[model samples]
Target: MRVFRIAKKQYLEDLSGEGSRLFGGRWNKKGMPMLYFSDSLSTSLLEVLVHLDFKHLTKDFGYIEIDIPDNLIDTKLKLKDLDDNWRDNPPKSITTNLGTAFLKANKKLALKVPCAILPMASNILINPKHKDFTKLKVIKVADLDIDSRLIVDTK
Candidate 1:
């Protein structure tokens, strides 16, 4: 698949480390026409936005960034190989407040979504750790009917 390099770069910059997005990462007024993320989002979240057909959003789009929830949890698994367990087991319903917010926000966007993706962002680290938060496995592409209520059409 073709990648939007610019968008990818902007996505990474906003989510350099652990932080809260100023305003839900709606647009890229500060970054390079990019999206944003906060602690609530896992790398998987970036992956979701990076992918998917955003043709309607703009042809200037570059990449889809994501936040993978529960990355640190997997890091605690204590695995020898990088792909030890090699499983994509996401928990049902998000537990964190931010996660719920993200789900609700994305759920509204899902109306326009045509599909979903998996980033395999969960894994154990030998030393150090990513933020340890439970992953949220919500319904993909279930809310594609993005109307005025779900998301405000700024365009």
Candidate 2:
């Protein structure tokens, strides 16, 4: 499988599970570096966050890993009423739709890609498995193939 990467500033949305204080304080408003597999950052993933948990990479697994969900979203809506619903019960999940990607807690069952969270510093400074994965390679909606398949090592 190909590993796509992003910067802490490139993350499309706020992270869930992490409380507002922790995420807001730790992460900048732009978001953090992340990796995932999908057709376009806009649609969905074959895998979503389920079993894997993230922690300091070196101490935990040396590499935080996430799977690319194969779920393909059908229709997308940004109804004003949807936001209005927030008055009574806004989605508890952190839903985000950045120009580069979309992330949400309550995303439709088949509408999210499994993603692995890692340190932006490590991705930039450390030795990535692939020599070709340049410091310039940051995950974006355009980077993913239209089919949602990650470009893996040709080897």
- lDDT, candidate 1, residue 82? 22
Considering summed lDDT, which 10 consecutive residues are worst modelled in model 1? 123-132
What is the TM-score of each predicted model, taking all chains together?
0.23, 0.20
lDDT tens readout by residue for model 2, 1-155: 21333223233322231332233211112342222333322222222222222221111111122332223232343333133322222222322232113232323222322222321111111111222323322332232222313323333
Deviating ranges (above 4 Å) for candidate 1: 1-12, 15-20, 23-46, 49-53, 63-74, 77-155
lDDT by residue for model 1 over 1-155, one digit each (tens)? 11111233333333232222332222111122112222223333344445444434333333332334332222222223224222222322211232334333432211111111332332111110112222322211111222334233555
lDDT of every predicted structure (CA atoms): 0.26, 0.25
- Model 1 misses residue 114 by how many Å? 21
